[model samples]
Target: MQDCFQRTDWEVFDHQDLENHTSVVLDYIRFCTDNVTRDRCIRIYPNRKPWMTEEVQSLLTARNTGFRSGDKVLYSAAKANLKRGIREAKVAYRRKIEDPHQE
Candidate 1:
């Protein structure tokens, strides 16, 4: 990247008008950065609920799948399990927050 910038003809953007020259230089820099940089995959976890654990997430997914499968028995069971899991997780989280030393 440094070598690419060093070899650039920066004098081409030296317009007499200050605004045009600044805009051109900024656009060139953005173009070079976009082309030279590699794309990255970043996993951003949502911050809506801190008590939402991986097990709870999997249970939620299972509940949804069961509901979509058109089976009343499976859906009902999954729903009950999800409700119990959520309640347990919330209680655990609250305890941890209120009494950090209790562990």
Candidate 2:
């Protein structure tokens, strides 16, 4: 288990690696925990308002797989994409609601 943890899974682990890593690890963990039917962990919704949104909530549910804020509790690479998607969605929704006529 320790070997698995210490293994060089990220041959090119970099800042972008961490940045792009968030959603990969997130989903992998989710897939694992889901298989076991356990709520392993939770996502950080610094401001609770966003998490309440249906879109946000769905992603947050994906975060339930298991992990700390900056750790891969499951698969690789999925974490980054997931976070980016969620962030963009939130910004888009906020803009759409704040000024429906602007866009």
Q: For residues 2-40, could you state the per-residue lDDT of candidate 1 as single tens digits?
A: 877888997888799999999998898888888787676
lDDT of model 2, residue 61? 51
Note the Cα lDDT for every prediction shown: 0.87, 0.58
lDDT of 2 by residue, 1-103 (tens): 3343455366433446675677676665665556545343557577676425666566555565434444475423445546866788878878877885565
| Model 2 ranges with Cα > 4 A deviation | 1-47, 50-52, 66-78
Query: Best candidate, TM-score-wise?
Result: 1
| lDDT of prediction 1 | 0.87
Error of 2 at 77 (Å): 3.8
- For residue 11, give model 2's deviation from the true position in Å: 80
